[model samples]
Structures are given as C-alpha cells and as structure tokens.
Target: MEQSTAASRPWLLLLCLAVAATGGVLQARAQLDSKGFISVDCGLPGKASYVDGGTKLSYVSDAGFIDDTAGANQNISGQYIRPQLSRRYHDVRSFPDGTRNCYTLRSLVSGRKYLVRAAFLYGDYDGLGRLPVFDLHLGVNYWQTVNVSTPGFEVTAEAIVVVPDDFVQVCLVNTGAGTPFISALELRPLKMKFYPQVNLMQGLVLDVRLNLGPADLTDIVRYPEDPHDRVWIPWADPKEWMEISTTKQVDSEYDDFEVPTAVMQTAVTPLNASMKLEITWDPVPQPHDLSPGYFIIMHFSELQLLPSNALREFDININGVRLSEAIRLVYLGVGVIFNEKPYQDGNYNISIKATANSTLPPILNALELFSIMSMTNFGTDSRDVSAMTTIKTKYHVEKNWMGDPCAPKTMAWEKLMCSYDTGIPPRIRSVNLSSSGLNGDISPSFADLKALQHLDLSNNNLTGTILDTLSQLPLLKILDLSGNQLSGSIPSGILKRIQDGSLNLRYDNNSNLCTNANSCRPAKMKSKLPIYVGAPIVIIVVIVSVALTLFCLLRRKTPGLMKNSVKPQNETRNDGDTSLGLETRRFTYNEIERITNNLQQVLGKGGFGYVYDGFLEDGTQVAVKIRSESSNQGDKEFLAEVQILTRIHHKNLVSLIGFCKDGVHMALVYEFMSEGTLQDHIEETEMQDA
Candidate 1:
C-alpha cells in the first residue's frame, strides 16, 4: 500500500514526478470519434444538416428528435445573428403549446457517462423582447431551471450524468413565468472513470471549471484541447495574485480527469510569496428552495524548478476544515486533490497556506466545482413504462405523452396517475382515456400494468368482447367500457370479480353486448296459425291479409312513398348484415382500389399479400391487405379469417375495417397501425438489449 501523502512528503513528491514523467510524451492530434456525440440545432429550418465551422462537429435539425408539431421554429432577431456568434444561437425552438416539450436523444449506451449541455440565447426570437424562465429536466429528474433575463447573452446549463437507460429525454417545462425556448442541445460521451462521483443515483451539475491563469481572459479551452470536451474558463484576480506559467507542456497522464495541457501549463499564486492563496465564493441559489451540496477538485503543478534545499509545500483547507496537510509539489508535474464526499454548506472558502517547512507559496492551476444533484427518482417502473409506451403506440394517443410516464411528478404524462414510494421507482396506477376517440379494442397493455387500479376507456368506437387478460390485473378495482359498439358477453372472470363486489364494471350502451352467454345468442323465430276456421273469422282474416299484401307491394315499388311508416325496433341490423350473421362491411374490389390510390403505396409484404397505405373518404388512414393470386390461402380460409376478426377485438390487435370479395380479387382492409408490425418491435427490443 502507498503511504499517506501527509505522513511522507518525499514519497508524495516522488509519486507525482514519476507519474508526470511517464506522461511526458506529447500526444499527437487525431480525429475524435464523435459518433457518440449528439449536436442538435433547435428550430433549424427544414431537414437541415451541417457541420459547425468552429468545432468541426456535425449538427442536425431537431425535427427528427422532437415532435415537430409541438413547437414553432424561429430565427433570432437580425441584431443577434452576427458572424461572431455561433450559428446555433441564431435560431431557437419556442414551445408555446403544451406545458412540457422534450427532445429524446436515442441510440445511447446505458450506464455510460455523458456530458449533457443545453444552451439558450434569448435574442428576442419571438420579437416580443420578453425573456423567458423555465425548468429543464433530464429524463424524469429535475436538472436545473433556465433563466434568460439578459438579451444577446447565451445561458448554458451542463451536467455530468450516468444514463440509466439507452435513451435520455431532455424536457423543457413551462412554469407559467414565460414561454420556454431552447437554442441548442449537445451530448458528449465521456470515459466511465471520469467524474467518479456520478452514478445511477447521483449526478454532478457543473458550477464552474476554471483555468487559474492565462494570458488571454477571453480564451476558453475545450473539445480538441480537452478530449472530453470539458470547458475551462480562464479566471484571474490580478489585484491580489500574479500569473506563473511555462512554455513546456505539463504532464497529466495519471489523472482520471485528464486536464488539458494548456490549462495546467499556467497557474496563479499570490503576488507576495509570503501571503497565502485564498479563494472564497458564496452559495448559488437553486430551484424549489433546494439546499444543494457541492464537491470540488483542485489541480496543482509547479512551474519553476527550485534548489534541492528549497522546498515548496502547503496545507489545503476548505471552509476552515483541513482537507489535506503537507502537500508537496513537483516541477512540471501535475497533482489533483478532491473531496470524496459533498460539502453541505452555504458558503465555501478554500485556503492554500504554506507549511512552516515550505520555502514558497502555493499555486493552483485549475479547479472544478460541482453541485451534487440527487437522481434518487429512478423514473417509472421499467415494465410499466414499456406497457404504457405500447398502449400509446397502439392507440396513437395524442396527449403530452413524451418521456417517462410518471416521474418528477409535475411532468408525468397527462391522464395518468402514478404511485411513488421512497427508494422505489414510480408505478402507474390509473389511466383515463374516456371519450378520447379511441377506435380499437381495449389495449392488453393495460393488463401489463400490474399496479393498475382504475381504467376508463368509455365512449369509444371499440367493437370487441372484453379481454380476459384485464381480469388478471391483481389490483384492478374499476373498469369502464360504456358507450361502445362492443358485441359478445363480458369475460366470465371479470363478471365474477364484479359479482363479488371487488370490482366496479360499467358496460352500458353496448347494443350487442350482454351479461350472460345466453343473452348474446340470437333469439329463435317462431310462427303460429289459427286452428279455427269460422265464416266471419275467415272473411276478416282474408280482408286483413289483402291489406298487408298491398302495403308490402307499395313499400317495395316506391320506398320513398312511405316516409312516415313505422320502422322495426332492431334498426342496427341494417348496417350491412352478412349471410354469416357478421356486421362487417363488404367493399367492391373497385372501392378497395380507389381507397388505396390504385395500390400505389406499399407498406409491407406478408405471406398473404402486399399491404398498401390508403385513406377513407373521411380522411381516416387504413392499410389494405390485398391477397396475392399465389397465396396458399383459399376462399374458405379468407372467409374464416374475416369471420374470426369481426368477432374479436383487442387494443393490441390491428382493427379490421372492411373486406373485398369481388370476383377473383380479395382483400382485407384494416385500421393503419402507425407504430409498425410486431417484427419491427422485436427487432427494436433486440437492438436495445445489444
């Protein structure tokens, strides 16, 4: 084991020198692998893609990464579009629609560290000259609040995070203070070993990364200079301190942070060698009245060589607490000291004092201060997230349903209730899509929500029997499926639960639906004839029969003539009842061709036939599956499929709209499943796992 630096000064100096010497060889410039980088120019026009001249990083429009309909794109005012400003800042994506708008960055590696950055430049893009204030969230956790109070000045927020999943969502939440807008978003992958404090449950929100001394204050070091793209802002106080620098490169090979050579080459020390170096800062304000804890790292490197007898040693203290004692510096060698835990204090003061045995004052080359952000909110339960996502895709739900379904509580998806427990990921409990224009069957995804207790899918065009899977939900207490076109009896398990008073089931106004199997069956037709044949009775019967025959003849000859005739009670049967007792519509082959634009757009091909994209007269999207001549299925199989599909309804199953059986041409029309096929979903799952 290595001896503690405080116990052995000579050993500390030797270790520093040896590590620096090993890293003495200069690194050659090479092309950085930016495949993991995501640079988004929010509000960029059209499907634009370009490379940034300054950073040589590729940037693309955010249209593909976000819901384009949720926000409007606008360029910053002409005054702010100067050549000196980055092109990203010249445009902005303003969210004036929903309360929360998000950009999903996908194709990421889970458990990897990433530097997430959001940039905002309020160049009066709206022309109202009003600055905006809003909250930003990373996935389901609150990252920071963005306050754009100054014009022409760019505001940036950065955090070093360890992503828990393959994708991360950056959301802008409207706080009603003003409209939310974003200029640019960027993500850069970093080595896992960097920022040791960041983990699955804790992130480091950057307060500042400072380069202690530099000839030009305006010069910042990042990207090409620092492989991890850490921004180092030059900081100095010439009034009380002076700069010490060397042209020779400083070695930082053994350091996990990998500080840039340029940043470590220069440092600041007190102007008077006898005076101690001190840096103090007040606490930064945070959102939601949070009292944040902080972690800090300080770097040191000696620029000048001293005589063997002349030593340079110092003791480091933060907030009057000694963090390290008797730290020795080596010439042109790098050393880093950081706190293992966070300091929960309102103010901070770091003092570097010369030890009694030291011959020179202390020097600080660079420093990094970060507020520890607790990512304790583990987002929604993964199973529930998957189930809810499947439900959304199946129904094409148009709510503000982006990102995690239940997290950060305030931004949980609309119409969803979640249960949040301490130390446990949130679980979805209730979903209400009542009167939401849902046209298909009840989604089986709802059953996947084991914690679910309440579900409302009333007043829809849903047309299948209740699924038995719904009854398997252990916690389900209430279900509403009223005012639908559903047929067939309710599931027996659900009925039992309702009978036992453990569940409240509502299935009113479903014309063909029934509570019992017998009620669902068609009633038998019976006829009777009078046995008696008296003279008066026969004359009356003959006169009545003659009147009935004339009425039937008139109705058949001119249907429009009997405008006020009483109609039959079972009027719903008039909706194209087939010989097989199914109520599904029968379309002519010509009608199918017209709906599919003469089979123009092919969606996919299956064993049965090719699927074509089409739209009904009312603009409803549909997928027409035309049977090929070489298909193994015969007319009997097609008829059987049509009969079965017309009897079953499920939220996860594609809805059959109509069928065509004109001559040799045969096709089945179904509601378009915009989310794609089961094979696509399986492939996506496999890729994510990989």
Candidate 2:
C-alpha cells in the first residue's frame, strides 16, 4: 500500500458536494461524518494512497507515476502526482542515465468525492547522473465502485456529503518524445446513489415492439441499482442507451404505445400529495451501436392532482381572440434511437393540449397518455388533417364556397377570388358582378367578411333608400349604380357617415335622385304661392333656415343611427295548415328578369353572389343578389351560413343583402351597405394578420 499524503484533499471533497445540491434536495442523513479524508504520499515511488473515515487506508499500484523531461520542459522522472503531507512531498522515481523515458499511471479514488494529488518531477535523473528523456501520460484503466465514507474506515471523514473524494489526471503532451501511449483512458466522476426517494414506478414504461408479434423485451433499455455502494441514478440516461424491435415502429398519434414494459426500478417513490413526476428514456441504435435502429418510450401518469377550478372550460387569450374552452389533457411521446440521441437526451420537449367539450363536465381522475415508438420516416399529414377537420366540425359554421373555413385549400365561390401568394390561409380579393337577373335587398351581415376588397351592386329589383350603415366601412373605394327604379333623391351629404366613425362611400345611378343637380334630377318645382304679404314670406324663410341648420347638426351627432336603421328581413316558408288561410307569395323567373333589365342590373360579387344596387317601383333603394351556379358551394353549407347570418343582428354583421328565387336564378335582396367589404382595408399593407 502507498503512503498517504495528508493535505489539500478535503477542499476538493467539499466542492463536489456543492454540485450535488444543485440537482435537487438531498437527504440530510446521506452525508459523511467527520474524520474522513483522502491523501497521497510523495515518499512512494509508484504507489497512490487514500484514507477514508480517518483510519482505513486504500492504495493503488502505478498510481502516482511522474515524468517531466519527456518534453522540452524536463526529464522523465520529472512528472509525479500525489497528495501532499501538510502540502509537501519528496518522493522520487528515476530513469536510466541519458535515456529519455516516459511514465504512465492508473489510479483509484473515492467514487463520492476524491481529490487529485498532482506533482511534476524533472531534476537530477538516473541516480543523480546523466539526464534521461521519456514521455509521460495518464490514463484510467476501467470503472470500479469504491467506498471511502464507510463507517469505521481508516480515513477521517468530514461534514461533506461523501468522503475520500473524486480525482482526475491532467496530462502534459510529448513529455519525452518517443511515441508514448496510455491505454484504457477514462475520465468520468464516480456516481453514488444520489436520489434515494425517487423511485421508478409502473407508469414509467419501455415500449419494445416486434414486427407482427407481441411486445419484445430484448430491445428495451434497462437501468439497475446496486445494493452495496451508494449509487447515483443519473437524472437521465445517455442518448443511445436503449433499442427497439426491428419490425414495428412506434408513435403517439393513437395516444398509446404498441407495447409498454418496465425495464428498471427506482428505490425512491413519489410524494403522496402534489407529486411532480418525470420519466425519461434512453435511446438505442446509437451511432456507435449497430444498424437497424431502435427507440425508447416513457409514459408518465399524474395520479390525483386536482385543478384549481371544477369548471370544465378555461378562458384563454389566443392571438387576440378570447376563447373559452375546457382544459384538456393530451398524451406526449418522445422518441430516440441511435443518431436520434439528442431527443432522448432530454434536449427538446413536446406539449399537447387535449380536447374539451363545453356541454359535459370534466372527469376528475388520473390523466394517462402513452409514449409510443414510431419510425422516423412516419408522416404528419394524416394527423394534421384529421385534427383540423375535427375543430371545424365542432364549430359547425359552414363557409360558403370555401366548404370549411379552415380547409387546407380554398374553394372557389361565386364572386370570390383568393390570394394566390399567401400561405395556408389564402386571402379573399376581388368580387365582381355586372348583372344577372336577381331580386331582394342587401343583408348587412355581409360586412363579416373582413377580407373582402371590392364590392359592386349595379342593377336589380332591390327596393329601399340606401341606408347610412355602409359609411362605416373602412376599406370601401369604388361604388357603381347605373340602372334601377329607385326614386328618392340620394342624400349626398349623409353618405360619409360610419357606425362609430367616418368612412368612404361610392354612389351613382338611380336616375330619380333629386338631391343633386344631375341630368336625372327632377324638373318639377312647387308652384309659387303668393304670400299673403311680403312680411310673412320673409318670416317663414328665416324659420326654415334655422330648423334646417339644427336638423343637420342633430344628424351628425346621432349616436345609434347604424343600430337603429337596421330592419329585420321578412320572409315566410310554406307550411301546411295556416290558421288564417293566406296565399303564398311567389314570382316567375321571366318577371324577375324583366325587372333586372334582361339580367342587365349588375353590381359587385362576393363569396355568395353578384350584387345589383337597385330599387322598387316605390323608389326604395335596395341591393339585388344573384347566386352563381359556378360556385362550389352546396345547399347544406349555404343554408347553415344563411341561418347564422340572418340571426345575427349586430351593427357590424351585414344584413341579409336580399334574395331571389326565380327558377335557377335564385337571389336575395338586402339594404345596400354603401361601404364595401373589409377586404379593402387589408390591401396595400393596411392591416396585419392577427
């Protein structure tokens, strides 16, 4: 046995204890008692020694070899590493005279916290004769568990967690020059049982899979705990620690693994209340391992933790939209195999939220999700499509021409055009409809299409004065009106109003307009009444002027004009028994076509129809809508959209732009919202994608 040095080893032991504390809380009783220490001797030629518990002495052969002249700095006997006795050592080992020689070492230290005794020897080699030249190196032979903190040992243990101390060797390259090599090189700190209370339970699984057979255990990864020496189960295994079956791949899409089996057991168990559980799996088929890669899967089940609220739904703010939905739990699966070690090494994490139904109460029980093994080449298309479709179906709002609004691709609708350059969600652009035989007033609900840009409503049998509601549009630019029987003069001054603020407006056509001096302005003038007297005429004129000024001011400030101006669209369906027998109101296609001027009345087009700004014989301004046969829309989707639109009475939702049922020329009429769709504002970088 080598003599032990009694200095500088205790300081190193204390440093390693501080590192362990960062991992987590350690058992207070797991530390070593005082009077334990590790030391090396300078008097020995090639022996290294350690003392634990202050009495027991452990030593290793060829542990403290030193060489210095092997390199340009000095001689072969110049290198030596040994613990200091009161921080001093005089040990000497020498080489033959004038011969450059190299020295190597293999030593053992406490697995817990061993200190390294390092030194260099170079002066007066060869028994105080000629100087020798040799190379020196340091290497670890292999791994072996050692206990230095055992009770009744020789060394004096300190208050630190472990005794003796971990040790590492520093090498000086080309010490003597002649091609020196040290075999069995290893440089890792010894580990002891670090986490005693953390036990591997049933929920931690290894999903081994076979091609067409049952679960295979041969490929599963395993971790073993030693009973004698205090072992430290690593926080996680290295990337390439496990292997999976060659035949079957694993995945978590189905929320389960093909086969789950426990490969290792832990001595520590989770807490009874508020337990925070974690599971990690090491991967097989590492780059150093053989081909035909394998994978590891770990599943964790949180036993009985309760949420803060018993209510099913959680209100969350997503991309500026306030969404209230149930807090759902989703299964997570992590895969690692061979080159896929980083994933298994715990570098990246995955998060998934489960689905919650508003109508049902949440289940108060353990949450279980499986970790499965899947081939690296597996695709995500199937999962993504199904998931998105499920969300759309649950929402239940059908998109006109677009099928489900969340579809991967946009479908062509009547007057709708989609942006070709954008990704995923394409933008809606231009909508045009010059004329097609149609009837009905505009539905204000059309404004919900925030992506709309250009809207045209030229000609149709729509009746009613153009409502000021349209002035609220922020993006409207163009407006067209050429034909239609509208009679009231356009209120040009009132055209610029908005629901909450001012917006642009477009107006034309409707030849009966008398508000402005145009060719179509009425020539009729009220017959001059011979005022009873000049005095009375002057008085009447003054009173009229004052009243007109006051009215104009009041109109400008009317707070709820948009909300109050909206009228409910009246339509009736034919049902069997009418308590008071009444005739059904219907019209033929030809009659409607004549009203639209041989399908000449044309306005703007959108996802639904070609709008025609028109008027009834009574001179009511209205918008006639005609649905396009070319639209990819179906009846079910159309009706669903219509149902929602008609029921929504908000000032922001466009009203039923109106409709017609002339044979295949079916259309709806609406109160013309002079302001176009929101699409206009989105153009030229006016808005951002929220």
Top TM-score prediction, candidate number: 1
TM-score of each: 0.69, 0.21
Task: Report per-prediction Cα RMSD to one decimal.
Answer: 18.6, 33.3
Per-residue C-alpha lDDT of model 1 across residues 1-690, encoded as one tens digit per residue: 133544222112222663334335555445457778899999898899798877778899999888647789988899877777988998999998888888989899989999999999989988898888899989888888899878799999999999988889999999998999999999999998887889999999988999998989988888778877788999999998899898776766676677888899899988765888998888777885367888888888888777888888887777666654578877777788776667777788888888888778888899999998778778898789889978887888888887788987877889999998888899999999988889877777888999999999899898878998898898998888888878776677776665454677776567666445533442111101101122333454565466457656755886553332212222322244454446676777767866765665576778888877665655455678889988999866676566556765545456677787777788888865434454554455688899
RMSD of 2: 33.3
- Tens digits of lDDT, candidate 2, 1-690: 122232112111100111121223323222232222223433343344444232233322234333322222122233332332211223333323222222322344433432122333332322343332232211111111112221111221111112222223323222343222121111222223321111111011112211111133222221111111111112321241221121111122222221121211111112221221233233433222222222222222111122455222222221222222334322122121111121223222221222353322222111111222121111112232233334223333223321222212322334545444432334444444446433444434334334445556567554455544444444544434445444555544333231112322244455444333232334232111111111223454565466457545645786443233322223333231122222222234443443344444355676666765544433344555667888766543443333333433434434553333433555555544433343432331244554
lDDT (0 to 1) per candidate: 0.77, 0.31
* C-alpha lDDT (0 to 100) for residue 201 of candidate 1: 90
